[model samples]
Target: MPKEKRPRIKNEDQYEALRDQGYSKEKSARIANTPDQVASKKGGKAPAYEEWTVKELYEKAREIGLSGISKLRKKELIERLRNH
Candidate 1:
């Protein structure tokens, strides 16, 4: 029988540590995969959501698995993203 291959999880140690600290699997993976060191060194230059266009907001919301996306207004999408 062939041995099973381990799952490919980047920053696996940090991911497991975050899980132990009670972060959801999705959230943990997001954080673990983030280029935190690079971002902090360069600083996050992304504009705030309030400044983004409604279409951009919709795209961003959909990318993060927001539900009822087709029904959510731009304002509601912003709120959900903020609180997400």
Candidate 2:
């Protein structure tokens, strides 16, 4: 049997729309109608530490003074940001 293809989400508006509808990032990406959409929702190759609005993550990163924050993945960024 052929594998089923997953849809991708493109653009911030679409991503926001899914999010607004109460879809988590992972779920939204899975159901995105296109590959581009999924990529866009993932925040691209660039790290999206800045995209986070959580006060703890932001404040933690600020406290640590970690440079090149954009390169860190979500988990690493969260940890370092939180520890800092």
Candidate 3:
């Protein structure tokens, strides 16, 4: 026999119907909350790490005796600074 297809649910009411019929909570949540609808209101931006100025990075590098400060990228500098 051919398999029965599940209906697409669009909103909270439809989700509640599915839940009442014994669908898993995970599945019900998925149907109710799409990625675009559930995306963070912070506009999907990651938090910026505390950035050190070039001079500050160099000073920190020197303070910690890091030998490769001049060749390091900003991220690398931040990592090295953190480790120190």
Using TM-score as the measure, which candidate wins? 1
Q: What lDDT does candidate 1 reach at residue 35?
A: 78
Give lDDT for model 1: 0.81
On lDDT, the stronger of 2 and 3 is: 3
Top model by lDDT, which number?
1
Q: Whose lDDT is higher: candidate 1's or candidate 2's?
A: 1
lDDT of candidate 2? 0.62
Worst 10 residues of 3 by lDDT: 40-49
Candidate 3 TM-score, true structure as reference: 0.37
Residue 50: error of model 3 in Å? Answer: 2.3
Residue 1 CA error for candidate 2 (Å)? Answer: 47
Off by over 4 Å in 1: 1-22, 33-36, 82-84
What RMSD, rounded to one decimal, does every model reach? 4.4, 13.0, 15.8
Give the clashing pairs for model 2.
7-32, 8-34, 8-35, 9-37, 9-38, 10-37
Write down the worst ten-residue block by lDDT for model 2: 3-12
lDDT by residue (tens digit), candidate 2, 1-84: 974554445555776688799876765665454665455674447455666665656565767566777666667777675344
Over 1-84, each residue of candidate 1 has an lDDT whose tens digit, in order, gives 984464556788988898899877777777778776763685478998889999999999889888887888778889988766
